[model samples]
Target: MAVKSDFLVIGSGIAGLSFALKAAEAGRVTLVTKMGPEETNTKYAQGGIASVFSDEDDFELHVRDTLEAGAGLCHEDAVRLVVTSGPERVRELIAWGVEFTRSDNAASNGYDLHLEGGHSRKRILHAADITGAAVERAVLAKVAAHPRIKVFDHHMAIDLITRRKLERRRKGKDRCLGAYVYDTKSGDVEVFVAGATLIATGGSGKVYLITSNPDVASGDGVAMAARAGARIANMEFMQFHPTCLFHPPRGKFSDQ
Candidate 1:
């Protein structure tokens, strides 16, 4: 029998969980992940999310810094939208119990904003060196307690189901129905039907032999979306972190 839900979300990272939380307000949500919910790239991220939180920081400066970092490839509208809405989103995260590191100064906003490369001001809101982990824990806790959300770990998505796969008459436009999910523990493929499906499997860092990303960052979402005939863009834009630490600390730095 096929499992049905109002919303089927693949992967349990910040994007997936955030969407699930909002979707639950309207109807039931089913969240599936290939590994444990915490085993995601977001949990391993050392740097914090960039947001304008300081009085010294302004939206234009943040957007300009982001554009410079993108090497002229960023969409101005998208950059503006993110920069403008970031502070509110960060505040929302804090309200949800994410304990960000605070400044020792008594007159500050209590947050110890960190400056990163290409930024004009201190705007990164972090929780020590494990900001992503802190955010993940808080969001996961809220998701676990939500009665409208159901979680399925160790479930891998095989492919998306579309109207054509159902063998029904051609509609006005092709619409996604759900996906075929592989339950790793049971070694069975199950049908997960939903009114809407969201894929947030993170990046494709695992595609490279050497990377700081977790094992789950295997580009599953991108692959699945491509297979479903989605239009992919800017795939050539690959980024490498210059400050990543390699194993065997005593080994030659160049070898890493």
Candidate 2:
């Protein structure tokens, strides 16, 4: 029999963890990952998160900076939405147990903000240099405490289980049912059925031979989605870190 839940989330990165936390409130959530729960691209992120947190900063200014950084490629509406909602999202992170670096001065409102390259103001809230890792650990702890969430680490998602394959109908639009997950340790393939399925796997950064993404960033989600007939777009815009510790011979990154 197929293991089932109300929501099946593939990947245990920040996006996956955050979504699972939200989904668990509504229904049971099954989170699957290809590696250990803590080993993710988020763990390697050394910078801080940017948001409008100071009196000197505002939503419009942040949006302008982001748009300028995007070089006319960013969608105005999406940029506006994220910029306007960033502070609340940061607050949500705080409420979920994320502890950012605190400001020593009483006037800075307790959280210390930094100025990054593109931003015009000091709006970056971080836990020292390991902001992403700190956020991940805190949220993952919350997820672990949530009774409705079940995390399956070392389980790789091979493909999406769409409605056409399971229900025996191939003519209409294919709705996703769940996925076929592989147990990396036991070499067993199993089915995970769910009412809603989400793939929050990080980008295909390792393909460049040198990236900040972890070893699990091998594009499993993109490949699975493409095989499941999802529209693949904007792949040309894949982010590449300009700087990395490049190791010669076979692997570009030292960790790999």
Candidate 3:
């Protein structure tokens, strides 16, 4: 069967869902997820969004701290952009219905920011402990309510439909038209066509024998993009957190 949309998004995490919501205003959007719509690594994030929210604290400090944390390899232009635009992103999140905890309590009426290990100030905005869950929920709710957005659950992409599939003679360039997807319920192949496509599938931690990631974190996007002539970077580095609790049976943590 053939399905059509103006925009097609593979993965329903924060990036995919947000792109779908934005594109829906102008055209039809089809969002496909491997399992349930909410099944994503974003829902499991415990850390908060870092942003300048206090008069005492400023953007320069946030930028410097982020650079320091990123080490010498951090890009100067990218760091500056983040530091300057951080506050606006925070305000945008608030306008989208994200409720951040207030920082000062009775003394002041503003966002209560926390400091991560790399952060220089109390600039990380959070909601109690599970900040990412809260932000994801808010964004998902709004995206779900948008009539232009259509979500397909339990659909997995088998492969991308490219120019080579059409026997094109082009040597250096290949174009992505759509994808061949497998419908788990019916056990049949479906072709989804879109003018624009976005792949927001998260990183692969499953390739490792042990990780804090979900079962679906198998580097699908990276593999797919690589096959389409995209370069892969930083495949060798793996950061191990000493604070990561590893039990015999439990992978990462116990129910809080």
What tens digits encode model 1's per-residue C-alpha lDDT throughout 157-185?
A: 99999876576554447889999999999
RMSD of 1: 3.8
lDDT of 2 by residue, 1-256 (tens): 5889999999888899999999998999999998889988888778888898887778999999999999989999999999999999999999989999998755456789988998988889999999989999999999888999999999999989887767767578789989999999999999999999999998777677666677778888999999877889888887665775666646444455
Best by TM-score: 2
Residue pairs in steric clash, candidate 3? Answer: 102-112, 103-111, 103-112
| 2 or 3, greater by TM-score | 2
lDDT of 3: 0.79
By TM-score, the candidates rank as: 2, 1, 3
Backbone clash total, candidate 3: 3
All candidates' lDDT scores? 0.88, 0.88, 0.79
Model 2: what TM-score?
A: 0.93
- If both were scored by lDDT, which would come out higher, candidate 2 or candidate 3? 2
> Clashes per prediction?
0, 0, 3
Model 3 deviation from native, Cα RMSD in Å: 3.1
